[model samples]
Target: MTDFASEMRTLIEAIDTHNYNYYTLDRPVVSDAEYDKLYDRLVELEQTTGTTLPNSPTLRVGGELLKGFEPHRHLSRLWSLDKTRDKDGLNAWLTRVLKLVGDYNKNNPEQPLPHPTFVVELKFDGLTLNLTYDQGRLVQASTRGNGAVGEGILEQVKTIRSVPLEIPYKDGIIEVQGEGLMFLSVLDQYNQTAAEPLKNARNAAAGALRNLNPKTTAQRKLNAFFYNIGYSDNIRFDNHQEMVAFLKDNRFKVSPDTNYFDSIDDVMSQLEKIGSERLSYDFLIDGAVVKVADMRTREVLGYTDKFPRWAIAFKFEAEEVTTVLESVSWEVGRTGKITPVARVEPVDLAGVTVQNCTLNNIGDIERKNLKHALGSLVYIRRSNDVIPEILGKATEESDGEEIVCPTQCPACGTELEQRGAHLFCPNRLGCRPQMIGRITHFASRDAMDIDTFSVMTAEQLYQECGVRDPADLYKLTYDDLINLDRFGEKKANKLLAAFDKSKECDLSSFLFALGIPNTGKTTTRVLADHFGSLEKVMHASIEELISLHDVGGIVADSIYTFFRDPLMQDSIARMQAAGVQPRAEEKPAAAADESHPFFGKTIVLTGTLSAMSRDEAADRLEALGAKVTGSVSKKTDIVIAGESAGSKLAKAQSLGIRVIDDEQELLELLGLQQS
Candidate 1:
């Protein structure tokens, strides 16, 4: 062979190895710049030699846009699994499998099969992909069209870095089945700069794979996890475990969630555990798949008309559902931002009847193709137990009335102003909804911690007592609240006492209570710690505010603009006149001790801590130099799990992060108990 051909071959092999190490193993041996240099050199060599290897990594950049997909027949049928929604249904399926095995064993006592063990895998909520490999080279890729035939999308599939282009098993043809998915984190990143943000990760992946332009698919940054070897000419496995091992051995991206259980009950228990941590996953999963482990047992008990009898899918409660968009109503928030709340036709989703869904803003409405969606079916997703969100229209073609954006504020009829993606009412004082929302937020537990104060109290004070803002709350007298409905002498006095107590709150809580636009609890705390007092924060310039950690230009501008507003300045003056004293947070003595157990660690507290509120614990931990956060992540050093610790604890355990479930141990760390 010529030296040029040999060099090209060497580069191809090296690039492919790097791709396998980076994508499949997720342990890149070289930096991205180093890998790029290798890739660029190979591209240069290919261009000079006028030769591109079939399995070259450069093809992963994507080829010319395809006109349309072509149909490809599979060697083996990709059979679907029968689904069971509840434990009873799963138990019934298991009973049937055991009975079949027993009958077979009775008929052939001399050659009894081993008792069936089950393997459970996550049922990923993404597009099903079937890849065909001939002599270890990826020959074709397709969707699960009809079990036998599928639309070929080889070029699009190549763009997925996780999908192997070539394998070590070079004996003959092989076919593997996996799910194509866009990671939620990747989708969020794409949406940050995308002209029209993708609604959800699943659709982003499926749509990209089906798009005619391979470049579009590459832009989605898709990934896949191979779980099944559907067909193989020169390989055989005695069990599902062996098949999974073979796939992993050939540099396939396999999920670490695959587990084997000897008992059906254990499978159910594992499914429950998976369900708890489902939301914590970067990719979506609607359910779990339970299958017989033994290959011979699967063959003997498989092949129903539509599903594999040996395997069953245990589906969780649906998080996404279609509902009719009845009407759109704008609600003014504490910041005067007008949010479009859609009253959808009541639909059961994720175990609750969801009637209302958020459209986010006018931009979201238009971007999601929901502008003409009134009285039309829309897809609503309720994930992470928050309010359901309207993803997009159920169909591309709309047949309903247009969703008109309100020109005036729905609460006080003030002319609305358009800000980037949202509409806001400039009249912060006269807007009744805005006033009530602001006052209620100010008295919230996380804000001023005013006890006996509720939304009802805010509304009563707003309507009857003439309380227009947070400053107005400080001005309320015993007579002002006593005459209001449901506010007798005792309740009025209690409210007055709570308001008095709230006046002495720390600056962080005070800043948070002000309901500054774009500023959250963490930002308020950071501002308080940096500026030391409300006066300093109010006088801070945009540049000075931006210099603080976590405060961006937008937030700094918001703070500068808010404090300069004449109405806001008057409100602050009124609050000061009414004796609302916001004291600066006490600084920790010297620097935090480096030897402290929780010092300099990022900690997450989940569930109920009986010793103290999570907020109080977070404050104490912060005093000890620990950064307390809400969510569990790979960066988290410790997770303090209390009673009934749910998804966060489950996620921390799954990630192999350290977890402290004992309340006493946590108390010791907080210095509340004798060490």
Candidate 2:
């Protein structure tokens, strides 16, 4: 009997190893027949001994149907994340976090918190799962019904091949949090043979996991990716990196796309990249989550009434839906380009009512076969949180009334000219929409940043004050604005003051306000920085412009042509004559001593400094030519540790790099005396 039990244990371990290799790693070393032989041997040995191990692979085939799910109280509460849809919202959240950290540091000088770093992970669009493990064996699995408790689905969760039935950590009880998902490919395969196809992958995974029959759940072939060890009795992680390492060591399948960053700017860039590649993944993701990397920082930030304050979900705005295209209309832009706007039946998408979608141009309309799509169901997607865009018709065979392209400008009745894929109105000086759009863009925040400016203001000035061009804005008199319907003496004076203040603007803002075709804020800034003066940028050739970073052939041509245009040149001359002094940004002076200790060193700053914030220290280091990074690796030359320094300091010490723990010494190195 002891021999049979021992053989059963060996066979169970072998089968579990094979299952992990086949499902989690996606690399099967044994043939299907060999795996079947091992599984059969384990079943036979268990029958002979009449005692099945708790973690045996044979148990994964599932048990008899459960009557109903039991309630489970979680060891620790699972917190949801605060969400932001745009960069502005994200910046606001970051501002609040920094302010909170600053407030906390001011109140608790003895235990000042470290600068908050971040870890970004994909926010999977599926059911949240919490698994309980005790004595190294999977004890219970449940959905995250509420933060406090949930319905136990242990039998159904056992069907997930990637989930570990037993972990190497056998000390005590722990609760792991993750998402249970159905891969897009798996959903496709299941739908191909199913009598009733699952409409969505997220709903399919949720419905399967919540099903009463474990056998039905097993048939769906679900998968899961563990992220957080929410509850641990015998383990503690100092940071997110340590927690992730622990999860990986115990055979939990974690996402490899998880990344770490020290600055919010880098995190925003990563979120943008992830949003761009959202559709490339095998699973569905609605957003990316940004969490404070340090566990102590998370604790300090703590939880709000509903979500964790330390973490925020940057949600992507693109959501596809089908709506009927009612009709098409033509609209003129600031550049005199005529675009087709499709009026669709109002549909709620991504929390907004989308009634209008862009058809790009005549060429796009023809290419997408949308010219005959009026009164037909079409697929529309809200991309980047701007206007919803019409992708195409819902069905390939769907067709309706042919959309007629206008031959004259809708705003000024000027005959249109075909330029590549677009139809342009040549009457740039007379078109009302074009003139108003240009003036409004000129006063935009990224441009001149004029106060009290709006499209209505532009229209009032155009109709009543004869301010047709942007340069005409400078010519407005007190009598001209105060005579308008809603303008008061105080409002007129404020507008005039804003105009005067906008004259002493930087070169980048002046260039961006020009509304040059195909050139945005980034391109204009690059031009201003590279050329350093308006005259040099205006005189630059196509070849010179093309050599700058991010400047393509079309953009270079637009810049060159815009500068050479007689109207644009005249406008610039008028603006300059109106006391507009566009100055180049002042460059920082070189460090006084090239041999400064911080110069040219790869430095890592950890923990909290009582004297100054981490950003200020990083800025000073950067000015002295030191590269201050987030993490400590072999390439790191020095580590400056302050109070409460954690894993990074330990790693630096273990690597035998130079360490500076004394605040007085650090101040001295930075060319300052301790206060």
TM-score of each: 0.51, 0.51
Error at 658, model 1, angstroms: 47
Per-residue lDDT of candidate 2, residues 1-675 (tens digit) = 888888887887888888788887788999999999998888888777788888887777778988988878789976656678788988898888898899999999999999889999998877788999998899999877546667799999999989999989999999999988989899889989999887667667878888888888888889999899899889888999999999888888899889999999999999999998987899888899998898988888888755788889888876788999999989888889898888999997744578987677888788777878889999988553234678888888756888998999888899999998789999989899999999999998778999999999999999999988999999988998898989999999999999999999999789989998977655676788789999999999999988875476888899999999999999999999999988877757656335455678888888767556665677678777886665677988889987657688999999999887655346535643222
Q: Which pairs clash inside model 1?
A: none
lDDT of candidate 1 over 1-675, digit per residue (tens): 388778878888888788888877888999999888988888888889888888788887777979888978779887766777799999999899999999999998998889989999998877788999998999999887656667899999999988888889999999999999989889889999999988667668878988889989999989999999999888899999899999989989999999999998899899999988987898888889999999998888867655788999887764777989999998888888989888999986643568887667888799889989998989988643234778889988879899888999888898999988778999876888888999999999999999988998888888787888788888778888787888789998998999888888899898988888877666788888888988999999998987875576888898999899898899889988998888878865747656566788988878766557676788888877888765677888899987547778999999999787645346535544211
TM-score of 2: 0.51
What lDDT does model 2 reach? 0.83
Separately for all candidates shown, the number of backbone clashes (residues 3 or more apart, or on different chains) is 0, 0
Q: Model 2 clash pairs?
A: none
Taken over the whole model, the C-alpha lDDT of each candidate is 0.84, 0.83
Q: Candidate 2: how many backbone clashes?
A: 0
TM-score of predicted model 1?
Answer: 0.51
